[model samples]
Target: MPKKVTITDIANLVGVSKATISYYLNGNTHKMSLETREKIRQTIEATGYQPNKIARSLVTKDTKTIGVVIADITNPFISSVIKGITDTCTSKGYTVTFTNSDNQEEIEQENIARLKQQNVSGIIIDTVDANSPNISQLAFDKTVMVDRQAKKLRLDTVVSNNRESTVNFLREMKKAGYQEIYFVSFPIEGISTREMRYQGFMEEVTEDSSHLLILEEPGVEKRIYDLIQKAKDKIAFFTMNGPTLLAFMKIVNKTSFRYPEDFGLGSYEDLAWMDVLNPNVSCIRQDSYQIGVLAARHLLAKLKKEKSSSSPKLLVVPSESVIRNSF
Candidate 1:
């Protein structure tokens, strides 16, 4: 390796004091002349002076870094959201450190603690369990949430309209003459997003317990088979999320039941595979990327001491319906 370039080298090349160079690096350039600042910047570029961010952070008490905790990075939707976050943060002169909780509450809590230990300027959490105790008491000034919402809202959150959108989508299916609409999901246990989607289905679906199928329930396999037999005509299944939709599709493939002809299906998430499947699936297209961008921006605003509402605000990102033969 060649010699490392330092701020001192840039200072020498620009004929300016090292403190002046430091001021420019620290965003205190208002005290310096434009000519001097331009020369310094030019020298920095020419010399390739890579300042030690760690050392600078020690002096400024700011890392200019954002910590992100995701529910599960493996999921395509969550990954897309992270892409939006990375793009926004990188452009804003901030770096991102992301952690995946693997959809476990304890892991989510531990991840947040670990991120905090790194002295990140702010945190953006795509939570595993919305009701996690860690969520209720997070450092409000330095944290923003996305994708998931707590049972009791305490953090600034940006999420798609889970409940209202589901209601509208199910109503659309009903309008299309879907005599039996089944809500298929993994489990609503303590997950607020799943529960909200389930609630939306219930609002439009009435008190028909038979149509609400929890895959984790005992004898669910038999119940699914029975449902498939009953709805051989004019039956549509509304899945709560991507994973649930995948599971149901596996069964559909195994049973050799063709969609939009033998049956109809619609899901909450619009996945890539859903597009290529025989009759393209109709579903909700949520702006997952926007959720990530908004969450990071909100955290950045908090760090800048921007005025926010007394109550934690829930920002809803709109969802677009991707209509196709599946519904």
Candidate 2:
């Protein structure tokens, strides 16, 4: 077997000291010429040499790794957020360690423990809880919550205008002469995204018995059948996520609930197939990629030891409404 190469091996081949190689590998160049940096880079490529970021971190005390904990990677929104995190971290000389929580608190805690063991320098988490004790216990050098707020803990948070966006959509529906609206969502535990969205929907809806219906954990056919049966005359249904939207669509197709006439639907987290559907549902759009980018950059700033004030620390980016035949 070929001998495993080390920094010393690269230093010997390149006629440079181990310390100089270390500085270049760790991105801590101070006096090294661009020529020297390029030479080392070429040799590294030719020799298939890989730096041990973990070992280098022992000396510099920076892992150059950030943890990205998301709720559901299969969801389009989560995937977009991960793309942002990966793009930003890679550009900034950091790598991301991703884990999916599946909306399970225990799984989330276990993944966090693993990240902790890896000595990840910081974390960008879209957590299931905004006020859970596990978030506070992470105790990392830097932690940023994306798409959720941890108000009790001193952590950076990014979220969208959940309440305002939903209210706007609801108001548009009301203006269009829709008398009844139904909001459907997955089971909401402590996840702030769903909770905030529900809060927003509630703000626009009154307690009139016909004004609202909220569904939790409905089977695909059941949801569609319910919508088909309950959407008496003019129906406007608000879906909270892609899965819910897709499942609801299955029913829409099966039951022949004509869009805009029998039912009007607005979806959050525009799924990939949404556009291909016959009616192309309207949506409230969140810039999930920007959210991820900002979250990673925020944590990197903390890792850089930049001083920041104890401001409210909640970033609520703007979202716009997308209109389609469903609305």
The prediction achieving the highest lDDT against the true structure is 1
Off by over 4 Å in 2: 1-52, 151-154, 207-210, 217-233, 252-254, 307-312
Task: Give candidate 2's total backbone clashes.
Answer: 0
**Top TM-score: which candidate number?**
1
Model 1 residue pairs with clashes: none
The local distance difference test score of each candidate is 0.85, 0.78
What TM-score does candidate 1 reach? 0.91
Instruction: Compute the lDDT of residue 136 as modeled in candidate 2.
Output: 72
Q: Which stretches of candidate 1 lie over 4 Å from their true place?
A: 231-233, 307-310
lDDT of 1 by residue, 31-143 (tens): 78989989988888888788899999999988999999888889888988898899889988899998999988888888888987899998898888766778865788888
Model 2 sits at a Cα RMSD from the real structure of: 4.0
* Model 1 lDDT, residue 295, Cα: 83
